[model samples]
Target: MEKMKPTLTVIMPAYNELKNLRGAFISATGALKIAGISDYEIIIITNTKRDGSHDGTPYVAEQIVKEDSRVRHIHNNSYVGLGFKFRQGIGDARKSFITWVPGDNENIEESVAGIFRHIGEADMITSYTSNTQVRKWKRRFVSRCFTEFCNLLFGLRLKYYNGICIYPTKLLQKVPTKSDNFAYMAEIIIYLVKSGVRYKEVPMEIKPTAISSSFKLKSVFEALGTIALLFWNIHFKRTRIKIGSIN
Candidate 1:
């Protein structure tokens, strides 16, 4: 039994994902239908290569967009940060609920189904990988550290922040930061939770993507810097002046 109650706008960030696009699209749509979501639009951000390589992504995006009215393409000829590309889609979203679905098949369609089921119950619905055994030891260690760090700092018992999430459009409009990197989503969650916004955690299984994870060392450092900046700005520097002056 499926009901068309809540609408959703799925923002998919695409790079050179020509190989994984078809399966990803199929799985997403199928899961949405299974979850009883009625009205939804999938926005594909077709980002070009920085070196002007022939990846056929824009052409693929064009073809896919033309075939399905529910699927739209945001073509970008130049390179940009993942956050900016996501923001481009986010800015163009036209639904009550919003979520970013990766173009690669790194996630299973079943996860999207879970989010849709719990979306209307809270302002934010987040998904974390229930089975960490599928990941490599190094990756698993890093993920655990990051999750613990977020919880300790924000006083939230959230398991993960880098995975799938569904957010209310109104709360996002009130969010303050617009980071253009891996730390952007974490900052979004932190900002909203600190403001007393409600959220729900949905555990789901993780799937391997067509391509292996390649987060560079530089990006990791940058993400850490963002975490520090956000922690200080929100908790210390910003909180100190709120409870009268400390002269």
Candidate 2:
């Protein structure tokens, strides 16, 4: 007998997380085992050094995959944004379902498995924090402000825009995105909702990681611009299509 194909693909992108990759890989594998789902694959993407120079992360990821048959690695020669790495993983995935487990291990292990349970009921599954407060004051303040601003501007009611999301890979492959920064995640969600795809939300625990990716002021303006473009495209183009009733 031969092994069956995987039902899910886990995309874990590691930039310079060689030290954390081992733990992240193990935690992901453990969650898969606890979920009782054997048919899945993990893609560890080590794009490049943050400064676009050579680094050890890619080599470390290569070694990890060599040790575990379930794991695999991709090392892009150039440094791309986090969203770009995700797009690469999405293109490389071979499973029906896909979810991102950030290299920093922000998602709790138990909650990782629970995401699979929601796939049966929705096309896209996202998460929010269970606790009332975020531990880091700056992160909490920025997160709240971003979510509120986006919801108000886009006419959505989502609690957290940058949290974990589990997507039907097929649908994701078909949708087009215009963002290459952190806003890429938001672009996908907004498209899904406006396009009438069924989505669900759940509460999950977010653990603090050893590293914090800088939230730059320039990225903020870029995201805001992406949102404006999406708003115009969705509302303006959608109204025209409805009037024409072009299926």
Every model's TM-score: 0.89, 0.88
> Mind giving the per-residue lDDT tens digits that candidate 1 earns over 1-247?
8644778899888778888776678878888988988799999887767786747877777788888899998887787667777778778888988888887766778777877789777768888888888877777777788889989987888889887888877656556666767777888888777766678888888775322433556667777887888898888866321111111
Query: For candidate 2, lDDT tens digit of each residue in 98-186?
Result: 88887876667787777666664676888877753534776677668888987887788998888778887777876677577778888
Query: Which 10 consecutive positions of candidate 2 have the poorest summed lDDT?
Result: 238-247
Best model number under TM-score = 1
Candidate with the greatest lDDT versus the true structure: 1
**Model 2: lDDT of residue 69:** 90
Q: Give the clashing pairs for model 1.
A: none
User: Any idea what lDDT model 2 has?
Assistant: 0.76
